[model samples]
Target: MAELVFDYLIIGGGIAGTTAAETIRQKDQNGSVALICGEPHFLYSRVLLPEFIRKEIELDKVMLRTAGDYKKNGIDIFLNESVCDFNSQTMTLKTISGKEFRAKKILIASGGRPKLWNFETLLPGNIFRLQTLDDALKIKEFLSSRPSGTALVVGGGFMALEFIAILAKYGWKIKLLCAEKYFWPDFLDETGFGILKDLWQKNGIETIFGREIKNSAELDADFVGVGIGLDRNLDFLPHAAIKPPSGGLEVNEHLETGTPNVWAAGDVASYKDRFSGRRRSGGNWSGAFMQGRTAGLNMAGGKESFKNIPVYAISHLGVNISFVGDVGPFDEKFGVKTEEIRFDKEKKEHIKIFMKDNRVIGAVLMNGQRFLGKINQAIMNGWADSKITLD
Candidate 1:
């Protein structure tokens, strides 16, 4: 019996894995590329899960690429299969179903899994985490059965805000619980937080801060949407030199791990930012796409460095929020600088720029989509005095 082998083996079927596979095929047309995804579907936009859940878009609209696309590109895709173990020395991986695969090079784009709370009591059927298409489908099914009901949303990130907006749109009474005193404490300043809080309250949604649920019995709600955060999916490669940190698997500018011929991208790979010189992990779709392309190029003997500033934008409840660069409430020891430029407080139009050593590193653009391109360019060009105006 012989084991199956590929020129490149990719784990995870999200944007990162698919983009990398496409890149590899473009460069080496005849190279055998295999992508193993634990999920059942092909590449789809995880960011659009809220829309899918809201029934605003069909399931097909969320898909980024179809099986036909993969087949046309000559990339083999393994769906609904989980990789159980990896042997870096032998350059081989084994799945739970006792299937073994060997590859010359491997890229880990396994991304992140939803972080759920450990409750002593069994959770009701209405609880959901919107990470995958399956999760979105389940949520849609749950909501279909119960058209309108109270929902307790946990966490204070983009996912939480999106869920709250979706449920609220369906005429569901929503209560948002945040562990911090403000929304997205990492990115939002006091003024920005105040604006968001006002927006939520104006929608007739109760927004609570600095609250921790010790037990599931404390809140009475029809459903609970947990958007707390994500944990890296790197337990399969436990013996690998690249240790998994709380953030994700650390990689270099080339998106390569410490081990040779191995790389990582997307949510799982915490790589150094070429512009900001900071180690970051698990960014938005654009960043992940770029990282995957870079990883594929580097793995295929091309010297490509990932230098894009991570950006994420969301429109929820009549508010458009965009975060670019490093926009961090980072440790005081880092001396990260942040400046807020408010154009219209009433309209919640503003831009917050984060800097380190007089260089523009990151920004938060509230209702400021026009500035995204220019600001991203400024950061890449290392412009210290980049000026943004809302006219």
Candidate 2:
């Protein structure tokens, strides 16, 4: 007869929402907290989806926490429920099923959904996109049902590379279609691009550049894996809450949104970074995890600011590719200077450092994950050493 009320209501059950719920429960034992997740599965690592596809790890192993664990933490877990709308003024939200919930403090960690390329012709069920556990499971099923054949991976970003690597590992003929002139055109410089292209070609991955997959029938492949990009999941938010110039909800250093008692974290929140002095959206796991922790702490009345260097890494073809901090293709207004570093022949390292105002702001490391700690420290300490030689 009455709507349930919680002290802290977190929407979405990915890393950000779950982490925020855990943080809040730890700090305030008596505070009522609940997390509403649209998916049926419990908290699981999306990063390990590749391993799951390879069957190296079971489905249970992918789960980060069990239902019992959430109960032990005193967190109310709502699964298979989607929040359709929210009223910021009353701090209340309604699910698509008509269930209503009210909260004193709200954290939107809904994250992003895969951006699908629109085609005039309808797509077949064989095509796949990797963003959720269900998507991974469906892809596994599809692969198992059919014989190994060419997998046309469309896109040149991190997600595309990941799918390409996984398909290749499974002995599928992989053809990568790059919409841009080079791989990761927004982040990778010429040297890094060259290195990646050579590696991909060496591995027998036929990479075609300056092409877009507008029609499903363009390539003759057994299946297609689309990884164009992700669009932030923010359709439910009110018009006033959406940020300007960009669509994501704008949050300050503390992850607080313009709406009072409301906060945002993860991919959906375009936050102001204290370290970079820029407002940007972070789709990486590290940034989302830290943002959730910071938002939870701040929601619990703790004064905390998020100031960590964002890092994203993927291992492909025996090479470790990592991007740290503000490595995106930023405009000249940011006064960013990029320096490309190449190591010896044996090591085959390609490192690109982005510097702004004589301070290290971002870096792209290939086969050099070991240097991340030192580089992060140097960036935080304001080290301006432009020349980085790894012995």
Candidate 3:
């Protein structure tokens, strides 16, 4: 309804957007900043959503910042406003509510939304996806009824696994289906998956690896939950501005999208990986926050670049898991040493380390947190430059 001008406009209130806003404030305190979040609530950690479902944390504690906090930081907060269309040439953006705004610079930090199955169907009352806080609350409300039926969860990522673990604790008959050979194929190897497979069996949760849902009929449960994958939110913007294979707004090293006066971070922005030689999109909160900060600095006329140092970590039902650095399939072409380790019979934990020239390049560990800090430090310290003889 009204047009407002600001030095920088951030289009998301997730980890990336909020972090970018803070970065801009830190760099240029004098510049006017505006943030528009589609969700009515303030930012919360998506990584800890599962914990919230498990009742590990309270709902009030999940909120990352309060409205008063934003006002204290001198940021204009606009809630429940999703940018529908953007014009690069005119430096203007229109929200779904038909409000228009102009800014000297824009940061598209909008995060990903959960991909649903059979989206055309109108069975929203029973089915759900755990992407937003509202979705979590809905699921919790459903569970509060103590439904005398089983719940089926689809997908194989951390989200699916965490849900399975939580539901199992509530004595719900659970069926978890993953259409992959391993639980987290991007981060785990066969040995690590074997460990998780054992854990799932011990917990009495059904798992179907390397198999997918052929149809909705195949899911025989009280409620069918499907969140098989994630997709970018760049559909609101023009596709010509993006590069290929990313399905994300293409950004340079500095998080600068080719679009004039616009940048992006988090799950919506894609950049080439220096080590894997493949374009990468980030979904984790840690990387999202860092990328958001970098983008914010540049958009505020300061200097910043996102250096890729990807790390993935998750804990479920008291088991700790982490993966750091470049994890790749075993290949003789890359000249690497792959080691797989399984510890104990009762408490079997999986550990796999990928090495090149006798230095650890990547590692996957389950039920191990001590080594993660060391491995993370080793990777950051550039220990790959030195080679050592191993027994």
- Provide TM-scores for the models: 0.95, 0.95, 0.89
lDDT of 3 by residue, 1-391 (tens): 5698988899999999998998889888899999999998888877777678777789887877988889988999899998899898899989989889999999998888877576317556677688898888887778767754788888877678767766876678888888887687856766677777777787777888798767757766766677677877776788686666667887888988877788989998887655444567877778898899889888878666688667888777668887766665444566766676445445656666666766666777787666666666655554552331121
By how many angstroms RMSD does model 1 differ from the true structure? Answer: 1.8
lDDT of 1 by residue, 1-391 (tens): 4688999999988899999999999999888999999999998998888888888899889988888999999999999889999988899999887889999999999888877577413675767788888888888888888669889998899889878977977889999988898888888888788778888878889988998887768667888888888877777877454453425778888898888899999988887677667677855899899988999898888988887767788997887998887776577887888887655787788788888898888888888888788788778877774455445
Clashing pairs in 1: 326-362
- Give stretches of model 1 more than 4 Å off: 239-246, 385-391
Q: Please give the lDDT score for candidate 1.
A: 0.84
1-45 per-residue lDDT for model 2 (tens digits) = 479899999999999999999999889999999999989988999
Better of 2 and 3 by TM-score: 2
lDDT (C-alpha, whole model) for all candidates: 0.84, 0.84, 0.77
> Which window of 10 residues has the lowest lDDT sum in candidate 3?
382-391
**TM-score ranking, best first:** 2, 1, 3
* Model 3 TM: 0.89
Q: Model 1 misses residue 378 by how many Å?
A: 3.0
User: Candidate 3: global Cα-lDDT?
Assistant: 0.77
Sorted by lDDT, highest first, which candidate order results? Answer: 2, 1, 3
